[model samples]
Target: MLRFFTRSVLSLIVASASTCPARSSSASRPAFIAAFALSPPSAPSTSCQATMTASVAAESTDLPRWDLSRFGFSSPFSDEIDLHLEETAKLAEAFKAKYEGKLGELSLLSAIQDYEEISKRKTLVSSYLHLSYDVSLDDDTLKKRKGALSQRQSEIYGDNLEWFSLDVAELDDAVLASQYENDPSLTKFKSFIDELRRQKPHNLSKDVERALTVRSPYVGNRPLVSFFDKELSLMRFKLDEDGKEVNMEVLLSRMQSSNDAAFRAKCLQVLNEGLAGSVSRTAALSLSSVAGGWLVENKERKYINLRSRRNLDNNCPDEVVDSLLVGVRSAGIPLCKRFYTLKKGILQKTQGLDKFRWSDRNAPIDIGGVSNEKISWEAAVAMVKKGYNQFSPKMSEMFVSMVEEKRIDVPAANGKKGGAYCAGVIPGVGPFQLLNFDGTKQDVATLAHESGHGVHDILAYEQGYLQYHPPLTLAETASIFGEMIVFRDLLAQSSSKEEELTLLMSKIDDVVNSVVRQCSFDRFEELVHTAREKGELSADELDEYWMSALREYYGKEGDAGGDSPFDSYENTSHLWSYVPHFHHVPFYVYSYAFADLVVGTLYNNFLTNKEGFEGRLLALLSAGGTKDFANALGPFGLDPTSSTFWTEALTAHLGELVNEAEKIAKELGYVE
Candidate 1:
């Protein structure tokens, strides 16, 4: 989970329970991988890179490390810590003593400097051992403190206080914008401040606004909705064919290894049981309530629809988002379903092929294990480097600097989360990544994906902290495009049918998840919010609504009208509980679906029009936090304002997948 737009000392990092940092406010906090949600990859092999497991803590590594001194963090933690309540109280006292209502440039500069110092102290909090304060990622004390700081931050940033001075309003909006012209670093601050001023007329009284800003952390849903997503360390599922114990992740990813329906069902059951476990269910409830509360507030905020606030924050226009959903659901979701039917026919089954298990979607192909062998870590790194280099020599160069310089710390080690992520520390300093690097082909792609994020962060970092992050809707461009690069390169190298099939199927599955699943989540959130506004949503009521949405996206369930016992009470109460977004930001899911197709368009353009394409892409990445989604996309001749813009992008890819899936089915002798 990460924030693209953090404004206070509390909004910095969204670390896990192990290294808990106070997340951003309810309005702006990004959810866990909500920015780049990757479902667990096909289970990895010791030899092949696949999905790695999520574990609890980091182990010591002997690799050469960065100075880390340049970031000004003497310790690993990023801010100052109060080892005890007295110390924290002192911090509160200090702020109140010196910072309550001082409205001068000098006062603001002092606050920023103090925050920078606090960041340095916070990073090394562990280095000093805050063992006595009860510091679980779920630590009660941490929650309390974060709640305090978050509330304070909200009071400041909410419609409560003026983010800028009255002096700003006195200058012409044009010349006022020019006030930060000399320094690019100040431009974003200037803009954000100006935006706040524009809404000054609608703001609560200054005292009320300041009070809201200061007390926001203490409010909202996350506090009441606490759930843990326990990482899997060791898991064994019974394999149907061999009757041998198999790693669930690995076995599920290898569904193509065997044509046994029994095996697929077993994998699904295993996964189902895992999510059905008591702890997971309880967590889901918390997530749902949090999401429900978010819906309530959105109604209060008076946004156009449940999804509109997210669009506004992403700086995306409504039409572009709508277009992406329309094109994908119409073209991509159905194609994915059709491909499943073809697989069923080829595999000698017909009863329930359309009911896809999470496992079978990306099973390793049965091309005699050809072309899908485990790639070495070096090979994965090289592929990513080459892909980035092909795009921009500088971008590629940064990849090397990161890997060789120990800027990256991925090797799929124990205690790291299952997926990959890039954390941009700041400008001048580069970003860091955490990855589970088993040697599967997907692992390599994951590297490319996160590296895409890494590259974007590096370029964006050029804009300094104020402009370093992109809006969520545009954040995935580099990462997904990075994936496209790897996929295209691999496609070029696939000399045989099996490898090509593997590539096509993989692409198809990705399209389904990104376009269909995420958009469905968006729609689901809308329902939850809309329903919650009318009345309080019980767990049963929430489940009923969830299944309704889930069925619509996946397909109507055959057992629905028969009063399935597990439908509400047992099925997916945790749907809302575990994901931090429902608690933090409502309707954040649309960004993924939007960004996925958008990447398709950008990649399509680059593939068809090579000259200056890389340059334009770089320019976009470099604009960072400053550009809205429209402006970020301007140079590429794209606009989210037009429904046609999104449809064209989705059509280009899904149309081909549908055609290829059909051809494959026909060749495999499946009936029309």
Candidate 2:
């Protein structure tokens, strides 16, 4: 049985909620990395890396196990947990023994110190479960465990929250005894928890917390959310494209790279139709979950505004979000619309691509696929190793061990899920990763990206279970940095201008997705959360908000011609269905944008000034969860606090990329 956190046990029981970091940092990208050459009939990865056993169920029996390289040494996860659990049992006994009908003279601070071992156990369990759930959702037992775990978390939080309320009121003593404490070491978390406890009035009773948790998983879950997330995405739609029928994603992929506006528009229409079709069932579950969770928590938690809790969870102040909205609002009217204006001219279209045509949000730059060209996963691993070796041989070898020892799995096949993730394995085995390796150049980069995470996890493995993975804001650092390594290496090896442009554009679009689009989403979430705090928004109202965000983030300012009809209330993946975040964690979206913005500046700094900066970069990666984000980058001289840190990172390549895009537009006689 998994142990829970108690107020007397831990400093601040996050007794935290939910998993899934991808919604913030990971959007489902098509199976682009399954092939590195960026061509069809994708080849298999040549590496003999170990694979994890990720398998779900096909109805009752099971989904096939996704086999990758496996490590020979028994996973250290069990040993770590056993040791921690033993210590925790001892602590629990001591707590019960010492505090049993005790005299009132013991200081509150002293009381907490007595239970440190138990607190550590809870932390260890949490860290372990995070990775366990990531790789594969096994049979019914695993799903039940997840639900049970969430309930247990609520119970723990309710306990600590009680102690938290008392502790925070006169927090100096609590601060002293807290594990994270005045040690500049814990840094942000110290402040983060301070704020959480500061808003103790908003929190509800333990019974209420447990009720919300127990009710949550069933409210809208399982085969349902799984269906939308895992199955719906994989469903193929046939589209008539010049007589031949094509899959919607395939057609859209072409529209992205083909420079054919009409084709792009047609593809988007069909995609919209498909999105529209699935609304009813998905909507029913989605809305019920939200409405139910909202009403219950609203009454129990006593938050002044509905969104206040979520906003607090995001680690962003309301003011910061407002500033971001200002940027988006200002951006929508001019810069974004201007790009569309140019695109409209190129397409010779009236009214521009319809709402459905948003599938072309990020235009793809195709460096023609070399039919016979091949880049092997083994070779890619070697390249990343060499690249990182130039800086930190230890980091390079760590990645090598990850791939060679079968700590990574990349499979390319039909009926497979889209996107990639680095799954930090439970407790001691470090992190394993998931990918669809179809032998594309980008496929190698994906390996590099996830490998960076794997290496990061391995470096921090010695930190023990409870303190391995860093905050979401810092998690993307190593992965993004790893991408820069391969990209810079590839750019150096490129024989011609076209190749460089291809790699450059690919890398730039990555930035656009990570920095620009994610920032846009972060802004949108802020608005919704804040407004909802004030009052409940209708489903249509929610959609309208999304449209407004879309227009602001992706549309040109001058493009709007007075209240264009958008079915804002129409088919939304929203509704209370499965998006475990709202139920679990609130306002977790900004971390990606934050991480990207910071990393972008760091990458640019390395590019312009230091040729041999890879070593320092690896050193940062190797420090892992042992250090907070700010200190991790201290070696690199990048500070994440200032607006300057972000602006410098964000605009680093936009100017050049925009110039080249404009030049290409002019060369094609599309007019600037």
Candidate 3:
């Protein structure tokens, strides 16, 4: 989420987390496979040449890889990267020499402009390296180069520019006011400056800040998270008794897609086993270190609680997050139970299964006329484009440009990162999307989700680099909304009651995943972090916390030992070790739940009042971090601050989805 090894230390400190969920490996295949038409028999020599030519053509049709040259580098190892790094370092030095201790006397506008320029240059290099490192995680040379560059960037920013914020925060209010009045351009950064001022209470001494920044690359969660990712990338799971081992991605994909109940359970077993032992212990150590570091920093900053720092960073109040969590537990949890209860009945009747295991949570149900074939990459792109076009032509055009420009990486490969994410490098440049797409319905939805992030980045470009990134709470709005529109388009295209029911069940699964499941993750983090404060949490202790949270949300009306829909928690307790968010960004899972409900409300508004909704929604995305969650939703007649807002939204949106899916299932005789 922080681009763990690739982004500059300064960017890590200031930038919002990228829109990536927990890491789960899935199946991988060729991006695009060209269909060849048969021809009449011909001469052997001519046919051989023709076949070779056709092979080349098919290879050319493969999904486009990212063109990193756009970042002024031919490759991660290009000389241009070093040149830019040197230039940025020189510029940082000059800027520091000119205005390190004389912030009040110089033109604030000029200083801010110089700072922005330096940040942009550093970010360009960092983003390029991060993207490169993500695809080539197995390349040790690239990994080392990325590490060295990251350390140098950290040194440059820490030694030369760390005092800028401290000095600005220390500036008298009257002085800042005068600068804004005298130079209207300075007003452009008032919000930026005010944000700094808001952190005045937590601002450490300039020397201390510099020390912390310079040492960041060598210490803290970054290095540990990097190690965790590398370990995860290299892990292999046994897929069959023949000893055919696959990467995590393939195993996870099989777990979800395999129709054989025994095989699905086997995939889950291998997945948990692969993540056990050394990997699990390493993950536990890394997580403990992260929580320990966060606790120390929060204590130093005198924040109210563990989550308050992230809440403040998101421009969301603690009470709002509290209300959101409470609502999810009270209303959202019940909705989850009901949905799963219905699903249990459907599986029992349709598949003749006696028990429902965690692997069956995403299992595909057999339905008449529902195709299990993979959607081709090209077709997936067109489907998402049509979905966007249904909402806004402008957005559809932007999505097309992103694909055409080769800014998206669409295939899953060995050593490539497992999850999906969209990284917004800077204001002027479009974001790059990384996905381990295996051509499932979920992958199509993920494509829509990340494209939504890209469009959000494009729409917010006018806000400038400092304000372009939205708060985490609002970041998922466009992505989820994009997913919803595409879902509706898919539903509209369904021709049969069986197909409709299948799609409806899939949508309900996603809703529960995005809302209740994510809230459950948040609860897990809360437990771990809270326990971690007293002492270091052991691997077994982390497992306990995980199972506790799992049962709380996934468990049903009866006790854990009774007739709960889920099987025993043995296979899933270690799953907490693999989620990257828990390591990269603490307490970040709740934002997914928050955004899903928010999008649900806005989506409903769009459905009821089609007129001007596009403009309003685009305006909300365009506002970026400038507007807080509440103010951004003001136009939609929604108030997230109200105690009942989340509960009401959950019932109206997810609850209704469950009801509809259940009705269709019952009508089809799958549920009684």
Candidate 4:
């Protein structure tokens, strides 16, 4: 299995939650670097280099060089990496022997300290392996090393530390409190311990937990997810651009941006055919295993439903998530339908399409002089920096450092992974960002978004190795905020009403994708998991579930005021197969919706009170997992659990954007 390790034991415990520094007269970089270093401060990185030709650059007009040696290794095959792995294994054995069967007996402070120490060690090694593999997915050596490290970590954990959670769960509350009173050091971990104890009701016996861990590679959804990624890496869609063969990422981007309706349609057709026909059965089996495995485990663990485990993991209540779902279904779907109907009118005038197909959902409206031209790498960075600088100079500085220090790998290459992500291993080392930059406006937003994550990782490092990563519920806050800041900047600076309309429409489209589409994905997962409890679902059945979600969120065809009604999801029935999140992190899609809604609320507050807003926002980013989702947002006067929160956010933010875009369309004579 591909090792997804970061932040040590917490990565496994939290399942994915996971971050570094610099020097200069500004005092910011130096302070961060000093805090990040395990030893003495070192010279700034000088070795990270990119080998991309200027013309062949994918999405990025300018490719970035990433300095990996800053992490203390030159390459995956470095002697230091080998020695570190060996040392990690040795330390794990010793630590296991010392603490195995003694977790309950040890003092709370001692156990916490030991756990933190061991976690730090494990995190550094595992993070290096993962970061290395992420950039070079096609490298067999890195792949093998990553797998070995992952398996070894899992083995050691299953054999030794599997009892840790059970022991923590079973510890008497009074005793734990007494320990905290006796040792002030234990107070720091109060939140962490509280969260562990919350799992008591769902935790299995130590033996059962150990068995699960030991059998993880063969029995869980992760391996199946790995298989899916590998297969997707090989699947290609032939494009009309010079008859070029491209991967799913390229195809999807082209479908969304291509001005030629026929090309877009062909791309969608190829995409649908490629996914539904070639790999649907394999995907179906993978989904079955994932849903079925969760069903079986959920039953044994006594979860309320398939989503219960995820909600618990997110530290959110069932009612809170359900309320969001209900609110989105009731309010968001209609708003989305309204926007798409407006889009249909615009497209009809522009592209002469009487009845839009599913492929037309993402069709861009051509507004002359608005300039959909590709943004250069420097231009994108400048735009992102300007946005961050307006909000927080610290954020802007960090973004610049990432670019100057070559901590980012930009540009899309064949076999390189799609999408964007930021990973930070330890405090002193900072964060690493990966992007397949194809120079679209969307790509620029992705840069801002991932940079936001990097900034969050850096600030949160103050929380230490054990608690520096936020849950998924809060993980997206910084990234989405970064995107919004840049987007709002663009909207404010538009040269004309038409340009403003284009920007407004573009932002609205993104909002729809993030909010409504994600809810639809959540619905699909709900349906699949619910159905899987009865039995395995066929490809056809999964397709129905996928289409059902589409109609629910996007409305039935012809509702968008087309000439005739049609099945909008007919061609994209197999899209669910490509969503790796379904396999890697079940029920994780809703977090995007949660973050978008919450960000809308917070962004409104920032706009209302520009004074000291950055400082307040930084406090939230620095919190890491120290606070739950609600408490983290409490400082901003936002409560996600409130019944009215979702609807209010949808109306005030996304709905308002749609309304503004429609008003603009009318002004432009595209609609009356």
Candidate 5:
């Protein structure tokens, strides 16, 4: 469930459809933080300071910091950055002058090649600045420097390059077809051209487009989003157990891992209260502005629905996304309830809890022969490498190269961003991973997940910058697949039934979080955006939307005099205020469910037919954005457009896992 920021400068320039009408100054990376709502594995009790210190010091000698020098910059203040910026701007101006009004007359292939080169240089600088900024959010100097460069980029692109796509979109269909027929080299950009053509109906006039792009840095919701990140990162919550205040990441980990039900509940209360007053109000404003701006653009473009814009960008059809959502609600809701019901029973028998509150949903169980110890940084890396090696040696080598090349930042520190993400900057630079490696089992899985993204990036480097990033629907395929292989490898190595049961339950927790919990998140977003059309919503109103979604998915407590596993929603109402994806990308959460189910089917195929499966998966990853999700799945003999594809995948994967866990729980006398 870690975030993957795969968009580059070229993506922003080439693609007209965006979550916001005006593109942000730093839109090079999709401002997605996907792990905020995901469930983490359980661990033994430790003080927040002790945990942070241990995480950093445990492998201080071994944990690798990103070698920014590889990006041709010694530091953020390096003179090379400014030199590169000037060169890129000049190149962009020259490109604009050469092909501003001559796209139809010139060789389409040559124009695109020049565009790609400019995009590559622009991405290199922007990526370094943004990546450097993420690790140290509190550094005002770095922040200001990045902002200035981004503004220059915005102006450079707005004035010099924004017309390229608009002009290309206006090209006659016959001209493009003729170009392709005349020179097969033009075929490499077929997908990229098709995307521009698809946005033709929504394209605004040249002056309007230029104005929006230039004013976006000041007028867009990006400033508000930045405020949200800085404000939340500065806030701290105090643990009731030892009166120690911790940041959001540590506090969330405690809420997920603490064996003590009361402690976990207190942590939730502290978290809720910390985010209550001004924080929630500001977040409400940010969310409303982001959604409001998106809707305005949607209306102007005449998109069909609230999610249509994002679906188009993802290269997924509206009907396919609809099927995925309906399928999850119909089949996934029942499966989620069943799993939680089993969880409630096991907790009742093991911990003697009379009532299962919302906070106890992710509480770790005390199954014997299972370790609650923290994993060391080195051990975690070795474990992930081994897991990848078990699946494919080439993939394992990619993972190792990432570590040896110092392409990963592997510790949690104050002012560092919460959650984890893999930034596929551009080709020839490989991928850089940002992780808050706290040494939990979930942290290990996260390492494996991001490494999967890195491997995918390495394989897809051949696609170059223009079509290098896959749509969101297929982006999570490799990460989730990477996690699954690691889980399977560990499960096979379990020494006893107790260990097996523990692993099964943890895996189920992850799957539910990815598929069911993410669907619920998407529902919450749907309600908020749909309601925001009537004016701004209050923080209290936002809370109601949050609770409504939770109730529908988890079921209300004692509804209709029927027994329900979940307790009343108490401190969970304002939880929506903290999820970054809601504010950053509208309707982006469902992609997690889409990817999980897709990978589930593919993994099943891998288990059943080990022959040539590895090559097929690699090919899919290498295809990048050249193919749509449906066509991408064609090689595997799967069709995502089918009505029952989602349901069948859910049943075959999550349902089967739940059934196995329930049987094991019964045999162990934890459930009747």
Candidate 6:
């Protein structure tokens, strides 16, 4: 069986399809709650404070939201977690003793079964530790334990299973095919085996692999990445809020819909200054180290190009990703330009602004009919449930059950991580969602988006450890689709044209974010990673790379030359310092564009055939990592490899939204 080991963390609220605007490169992207900072929460509405408090009280009473005990653990310090770790360690030793240096001689069934058993146990323990740490990064004990356990687990895998894939890859194709035909048990592992074989050319000698693995903890880029996250998390930025000195998080939340452009601009200035002054040097060094490691590996591996390494992991063909990039850039950038132009016009008419700042990218257009009031927790849940239930009752039930079981941590508190992500622990234990929910429409969409990931996790649990998680290319299917479903439903219920326009513009922003902005980020990554081969990049060089990408995508404001409304790129240069993805997972940002286009295409099909779409969509999610990207989308008649797929999806879906919003603007007299 393909063991499903699922980890789902998506950040919502980058009006462009990202968790955060900073997510231009994988190094800068957050791992789980990628978008936690993209959209700030609404100020608690004075009118609904009582109701909000009551709802929080009612929800808080049901503590211990996640059922970690199902995995034979409760907390990070629980005896069960330690006992499980000990058991896993022993199993690792026993497995190593049995299989080391004898892998080619063992029957395929025996090899797979042994591997599966060991992986399942290790996943259970490690997954629990990860969940505990994500929810409470401030807990030093838990943080240390998570790190120690992760290192130990890595060691165990290295020591015991270092040769498994290389050996499997070395097997004769005919012999492997014969084994598969003779042993029915191997059928489920076909995808896993095929993916392993893809790495055959790059596989190192067992000794070298083991050596690298053993020294990995100290020599790898992880330490640098960890330092950046720790340093950024610890550095406090003081913002004057209502004459009170508060942390950056407070200002970020207040800045979202501050109604005061000056205040928002100041908050943006403070954020940039703080990150630039204290964090940029560390971030620049980390990126250099990470990019340097990639260059070294690329040379050693002798892969086709800079991205072949990540392409192998994603099981994506080079042509497909190339097509995706070209298609998105050609189709998405112009549409992005059009949307921003419309936005500038509307904001100018509504807010009386001479020109907009980068901070005003997500500024709300105050329409007479739209409500900017804070949504209560209860109402947010109801809205999400209603929206989801419109598509699938099963999905709606999943959201409700998460709430009832307390599987969601929904408040922003000191020491709690920013952003939101669905961490799907091992099978038999449902997924847990972490959110800094601040009761905004974006927050509700985030609720739906992360819930979509939880649903995908729940469905994919049957695939077991190796097959449970989809590649990054297909990873955002359910989550982005969830956002679309909710957004459409919300638009359907809008009472006026202005309200509808607000929702439409937001969704369009998300699509552009996901597609155009992310592709631009990918372009930056390609440049920087290529540049890093020459030497380490200084902070200024990194800023130059960022500004170059912005100009290409957003364009310059005046002279009628480019897409942007201003030339304020200098202030946002340090923005790259905070994205977690770029540091940890290179070449991963394109997956957002890949997912957005795929989901947009799939969603259009669903609209055409609503009666039969649910089953097919569910089946796609359930396949998990067992199928490659093309096969997963085959049912929807979407070919990601084709340029048409990307261009048509962008024009038909995102372009339509932009066109409709323009029409609405003209109708409302905001534009002619």
**Best candidate according to TM-score:** 5
Q: Which ranges of candidate 3 are over 4 A from the true structure?
A: 1-18, 21-61, 556-560
For 1-672, candidate 1 gives per-residue lDDT tens digits of 122221100000111000011122343222211111111111110001112222111233542333344444343222443333225335545654564455332334444344333332322222122111111223455434444433333332332212233233334556544445534455445443443354333333445434443443344343444223222333345645677654433443444333454565565555545545553555445555666655654554555665665565555666666776776667656655665555545443323344434334444345424654567768888988887776678878877877876665444333233333455544555465545444666656666766666777788875545446676766677777777787777777877655676577666656655567556666666677677656656655655666676666666533455321111222233343323344434455555566667888888778788889988988888877677777777888877677576666666776676577668656644546
Q: Residue-wise lDDT of candidate 6 within 326-427, one digit each (tens)? A: 887788888888888898889888888666777777777788757778887789889989999999998899879888887877775555544555655556
Could you tell me how far off, in angstroms, the CA of residue 89 lies in candidate 3 after the best superposition?
1.0
Q: Model 2, range 111-146, lDDT digits (tens) per residue?
A: 543433354444445434433433443334544554
lDDT of each: 0.49, 0.43, 0.71, 0.67, 0.71, 0.67
Indicate which candidate wins on lDDT.
5
RMSD values, in order shown: 7.9, 10.2, 10.1, 7.7, 6.3, 6.0
- What's the candidate order when arranged by decreasing TM-score? 5, 3, 6, 4, 1, 2
> Compared with the true structure, what per-residue lDDT tens digits does model 3 show for residues 1-672?
111111100000101112432111000000000000000000000000000000000011266687766777788888888898899899989999999878888999899888877877777777677778877889999988888887787788678877887788899989888888889988787766766676677767877777766776777666877787789878887777898777776676666766777787787777777777899999999989988887887888788987887776676899999999999999998888788788778778777766688767777776785897888889989999999998999999999999999998777777665556677677766577766666677667777877888888799878787667677778777778888899999999989888988888877777787678778878898999999889988889998898888888877323357555665454786888776667766776677778879999999888898889999999999997678899999998889999999999998899888888888888888877
Candidate 5, residues 1-672, lDDT tens digits: the string is 112253210000110000011111122111111111110100000100001111221213355577767788888888888898899889989998888888778888999899888877777777777678767878989877877776776787778877877788889888878888878998888888877777777777878877766766667776787787778767787775697677776777777777777877787788888889999999999989988887788887778998887787776889999999999999998998888888888778777777677778767766874787989878998998999999999999999999989998887767775555667767887587766676777667777776777787788878877776777788777777888888999999988777888888777877787678778878998998899889988899999999888888878775334345776556897878876666666676676678779999999888898999999999999987788899999988898999999999999999999999999898898888
- The candidate 3 region of ten consecutive residues with least summed lDDT is 29-38
Q: What is the lDDT of residue 580 in candidate 2?
A: 29
Error of 2 at 410 (Å): 1.4
Against the correct fold, how does model 3 do in TM-score? 0.91
Better of 1 and 5 by TM-score: 5
Candidate 1, residue 320: the lDDT equals 64
Residue 506 shift from truth in candidate 4, angstroms = 0.7
What is the lDDT for 298 in model 1?
Answer: 54
Instruction: State residue 173's C-alpha deviation in candidate 5, in Å.
Output: 1.1
In model 3, the number of clashes is: 2
- Model 5 regions lying over 4 Å from their true place: 1-62, 240-243, 559-563
Q: Kindly list the per-residue Cα lDDT of model 4 for residues 480-570, writing each as its tens digit.
A: 7887899999888988888898888777776776678778878898899999988988999999999888777776666454332232444
lDDT, candidate 4, residue 190? 73
